[model samples]
Target: MGALDYLSNFCTVTTTRTKHKAMQTVEIKVRMDCDGCERRVRNAVTSLKGVKSVEVNRKQSRVVVSGYVDPNKVLKRVRSTGKVRAKFWPYVEQHLVYYPYAPGAYDRRAPSGYVRNVVQAFPDHSSNAPPQENFLSFFSDDNVHACSIM
Candidate 1:
């Protein structure tokens, strides 16, 4: 019984560590006016521990970091590079958006296929189709208590 208990504890610890080190991809948007700006952002993020790869697109001002690091930590690291403060990439591919041209979801500076992701992320229960109503449900003539008028 003691051996079983020890195995269970070891398994729990392994699971917790695996969860914490899961690979994640974080996308950040920072204004890069020139080659130097792009280089700075890339180098800054690449130096972080556990970062597997960093891709920077100067035109779209996007930096995609793939690794096993906390997302908030990656964002903070990017901001420390002495460039324009970074923001999590708020845009999604235009093709993935339910309403690509939604008023606040469209950005002029986003990449050709991407749009700001301001549309609702979850379905609103209030907007769902109302429950089907039966016109005869209110009448009880079919039952034992038929109306006298009938």
Candidate 2:
């Protein structure tokens, strides 16, 4: 009986260590529009066992969970909060969707189906190539000091 008890204890410890080593972090994209949406998603994920932390970014529609948790389980829990279109965060990044194998999407010559965006790190050498410009920067006014002096 004592030998059996010792064996069981050793098995339990080994399994626990394996589970801890398998710990992972998963990022999910959830379309949370308001405080209620964010709260629902957060609450659902926080209840999962081995979950160390939960972060929700409504503007980016992102939820990041960290701890000894199963990624699939975390995703399912977030979806159960009335979010049906939940997906892994990487799918939402345009670069990964188009040029996944390329490093940093730095090439000026984009492959087929590439989503064009400003801030191209490597501009094409062709003379006709358009200059790189951040689309968002056009609308931003960075001359705050100039305006303040006026």
Candidate 3:
């Protein structure tokens, strides 16, 4: 068989296009005490491919990354920067310590195992003076009759 005949018998050609996944936002909770910790976490996350933006909130110790990157991969990358305690945002919620699931704590119709602290305001019965008009007036303008002076 000639070269053309041999090639036709042994090979086939096809073209395929890969569809890139849409980018998504991933929020991670990292307890960064200072600017260095925040910088490290930011650098680690931004280094990943397809990262669109990185937002760091030092007060809340939160990092928000937007891109086509996988969340798990981003988490791994952040942890690789010597931060072993990194966790997803929702997983770090304050009430999660008491209730792992929303239905357990957040749901109003759920059982009573959820311990939610509710504050009820009770007017002081001892005071009928329409409450102190200026609570701060006690400290700001020291009264000559102040009991503490004694």
Model 2: residue 57 alpha-carbon error in angstroms: 0.6
**TM-score of predicted structure 2:** 0.51
User: Per-residue alpha-carbon lDDT of model 2 for 63-116, expressed as tens digits?
Assistant: 899998889999888888889899876433354443444455433433343433
Q: Model 1 Cα displacement at 134 (Å)?
A: 21
**After superposition, candidate 2 runs with Cα above 4 Å error:** 1-21, 91-150
Q: What is the C-alpha RMSD of each candidate to the true structure, in Å?
A: 10.5, 13.5, 16.4
- TM-score comparison, 1 vs 3, better candidate: 1
lDDT of 3 by residue, 1-150 (tens): 699998996787776987896889998877889888888889989889899999998876678999898899999998998989988774333343433343333534222333222221223347653654555555534565564323
RMSD of 1: 10.5
Model 2 lDDT on a 0 to 1 scale: 0.71
Which pairs of residues have clashing backbones in candidate 1? Answer: none
List, in order, the clash count of every candidate structure: 0, 0, 0
TM-score of each predicted structure versus truth: 0.67, 0.51, 0.54
Model with the higher lDDT, candidate 1 or 3: 1
